[model samples]
Target: MQGRKVAAVVAAVGALAFVVLAVLLVPWDPVPGGPLHPPPASSVFTTDQIDRAEDFAGLQRIWSWSSLAVSLAVACVLGFSRLGAAFVDRVRGPWWWRAVVAVLALTLAGRVATLPFAVLLRRRVLAYGLSHQEWGAYAVDLAKGVAVEVVGTSIGIVVLVGVARRWPRAWPAVAGVLVAGLVMLGSFVYPLLVEPLFNDFESLPDGPLRTQVLALADEEGVHVDDVLVTDASRRTTTLNAYVSGYGSSRRVVVYDNLLDGGSSVDDREVLSVVAHELGHARHDDVLIGSLLGAAGALMGVGLLGLVLGRRGSGPADPRTVPRVLALVALASLLASPVQNGISRQIETRADVDALEATGDPEAFVELQRDLALTSLADPTPYAWSHFWFGSHPTTLQRIALARRFEE
Candidate 1:
């Protein structure tokens, strides 16, 4: 009992430390003292545009939420009941092998259970002319996604079970460090190993746009391997760009659709997008985020240790994996607000950096508006939904920030 209490204390302390570090590092006020009076949605968008956006957004929100609900319900049923334990126990293997098999089975089951909603969501996107993916391609992508999830979940569960089996008493502290380290390592390698599986990439040709992008990278004092374009149009028409990985693996990736003939993005707007990504690179936001995530993982491991202690078993027993997975799902849902809040602020800082890098706010604003129009993003989302789930600043908030630079 005392040991369980200690694990609980460790969890509490780890959580507090994560919050403190996030506060210290996150750019909470990215647009400092920049007066912001966002124009009404109707002021910028016409009745038709607003109506279209609202309709699409409403349906998207519904399907997305329905999928999430189904996933969580599955998790709860498996975790909070004896059925999950019995299901995993039926697998015949060595303890670690059983753990691995259990994770694969459970993860695949959850994915299958929610697959209908996923199909519906995809169909809706197709209806709206957002996704170009055919049923065959979508199935292939879905399989890849399920494979990735299975591999990741298996690794984590196996590690947890093995460590707990080896060190019953002190596994909290040990697993905490181990989980944190794995988070950092995963962040470093994921871009290299996992991302290529989904998208095909080609370096931007030695053209004026590529040259300007290189110059922008130099101006921002960020080192990147190359500016590459990805065939994202194969999946969706969304204009997007990102920076991923760190050190040698770091690079800027732009969606090919961003440069397509039909795109509203001009060279300047593209620069704005690249500059925003560069801002993340400039501040090493990935490293910062990795650190935060590592901290959160450590805290989660501590709490999980306490939960397993209460259950009188840890991951070493294959049956416990389902319960663990369920708890993890619940924890993730609970932690979303803090995770999303920090993300929004980090994205805001990147936006501010874009404005500074280009010294062109009107182009940035235009880019934001066009992106919203393209995605059919609701200009003003429900307050609760935005607070809980909004990762980046709302499109209007971004435009408003750019407008601040106009002054």
Candidate 2:
């Protein structure tokens, strides 16, 4: 017993050290650039914008909290219920097929259960004029999302069951590696495969904006075969952009709303958006994110193995899958803060890169403000909420960062 206690202590210490190292290694400061004048506070937002922002922030908080609660409850139900095992037993198929069916049923059930919250959130988005997608279109998108989830989760469960059956003792480490590899592969393929289902993407026309985007990429040492413009205005009024995939698949995607004058995003704001995405490409943020995800998976699986080993049940045992799934869900929820912390750091660095690459802190500041207003983002989220759930820094923090860059 004393030996076990010592081992636990040592393990805890090691995990703490790893977390500290990760946080410390991340660059929290903006990149160096020439001195520039800071934009006036008044220029960031007007009185009317602030009032609108406050209202939107309150709505977002409500939606975020409710959605999280609903999701957690659903996860608990699926994970703790014997329904998964019963469903598997009722299905007449090979062991793999049985696992697949069980997973699909559970996944579908969870999706159905949480659909009300999804609808509620959508309603709020519509109310705020953030989304223009009709219910019909929304329903179609939701169906597609579920279909993708079913296929992906089914394959994953089958592979996991197979690994467990083949190597009960070694399954955790093996499965961890496999899961990590799949994550990387998924990131590599998502832009090509999954993204197209939601929106049509077309290459940006040869114009000043496109030329400036390509030039920014070159300056940032990021290769670009093309800049794709996504038709996001059909569903959203939010102005946004992103960098996805890697190598030949790597591309910067800008929202059509930003380019088509659906919002207040001007030419300079568009350039700022492109520059920020290019920063992601320049730093290979996708690869780094994949590696982080892989590490987290490895850790989670190892911990899962320890817990299951203590219970004297392996993944090969079909009866144990429900408990395993439950544990995984719990583990993921517990790890979210850490995961989000890493994300925020990466995003902040990308923001810094955007500022440096453009050497236009004023434009960056204006774009950040405009983005928040356009997306109806909360200017100042609750501290605990931001720490635990926020993937990007708060709008206020971003604005502050831009101001600091000017100094």
Candidate 3:
């Protein structure tokens, strides 16, 4: 018993070490002097625009929150109830196979339970002119998402149980390291293996825009393999661009919507967008994030082991998979604030990078306004909600920062 607790403590300490390393390594304050003071939302948006955005964001919040609640409930009910165990018991298979089946069954159940919420969100988006995806297309995307979850989660669960079965006494420490490795592996390959399952990509054709993008990457010292464009406009109307992967695999992706939709998005705006992503790449932000995630995964798995052993659940038992999943779901929810805080800081630094890289404060600020109006983002959300769920600076705050940077 003491040994199990010690294992958990060791993993926790390791995670703490990684956290400290991250703190020391990351440039948390990319902008010198102090935090930028954002102008009032009214300064940038009209009363009518604010009212409409508030209305839209408020309703969107309700749907999203309801979905999250129902999904958590589904996880807890299956995990705490005998239903999940009973389903596993009915299956005749080796322990490994049963473990895989148990994970899939519970994951599918949770997803199916939350499906209605998904439909509601989709309908709302369609009505709001945010999405034009057909019902069949939506279903296809949803199924693809489920398949990815099943495969990914199944592999991790199998590893967790396998190591536990082999080294019951020290499995917490072993599984912590193993799960952490999996986290890094997943993050690294996600851009390659999983991304294509959803969208098709084509290289940005030879043009002044593409040439300038390449030049910008060169200036930022970000090794972008290709400036590719995604068929994102087929589903949604949001303007976005991003960089994913690192090393030789790194590439910049811009949404066709951002390029072709509104006259508001000009070459400079697009450059500003890609520059933001390049900030992520140049700083190895994804690498940093993956490192942090790896540490978190290790910490979570150690805690899971401590809980499982304390409950006398067999480490390798298929019956315990649901409980394992439930705990993960809870841990994720509880970690949101801390995770989002870090993300917001990282995103802010990226914004700073975009400003410095482009030296186009006017373009950056206008692009932000366009993005906010396009997405119906609330310029100023509740303090508590922003702390908990906001992963990026509010649009108004971003505009203010660009203004400050220009000064």
- Cα TM-score per model: 0.97, 0.89, 0.97
- Per lDDT, the best of the predicted structures is 1
Instruction: Write model 1 residue lDDT over 1-407, tens digit each, in one string.
Output: 76577678768878987989888999887886755677899877889999998898998899899888989999889878998889877888798888888788778888989888888888888998998888999899889988988888888888888888898777777778888888888889988898999999999878889899999999999887799899999999888999988777777899999998789899999999999999999999988999899899989988887887876855567788889999999999999999999999999999999999999999998899888988889998998999999999888888888877887
lDDT of 3 by residue, 1-407 (tens): 86468567856766796688578756678666697888998899999999988988887888889988988998888888998888889999898899889888887888888888788888888888887888999899989988899999999999888987887777777788888888888877888999898999999989999999899989988777788899998888888988777666677799999989455799999999999998898888888888888888877877787777777734677788888898999999899998888888889999988999999999999999989888888888988989999989889889989989778
Q: Write model 2 residue lDDT over 299-395, tens digit each, in one string.
A: 5655666666665645676656666767877777788898898888789888888888888888887788878888877666677988988899777
Report the CA-based lDDT of candidate 3 relative to the real structure: 0.85
Per-model lDDT: 0.87, 0.75, 0.85
Q: Is candidate 2 or 3 superior in lDDT?
A: 3
Looking at model 1, residue 386 earns an lDDT score of 96
- At residue 167, what lDDT does model 1 achieve? 80
Which lDDT value does model 1 have at 330? 93
| Residue 60 displacement (Å), model 2 | 3.5
Instruction: For residue 84, give model 1's deviation from the true position in Å.
Output: 0.9
Off by over 4 Å in 2: 1-25, 28-44
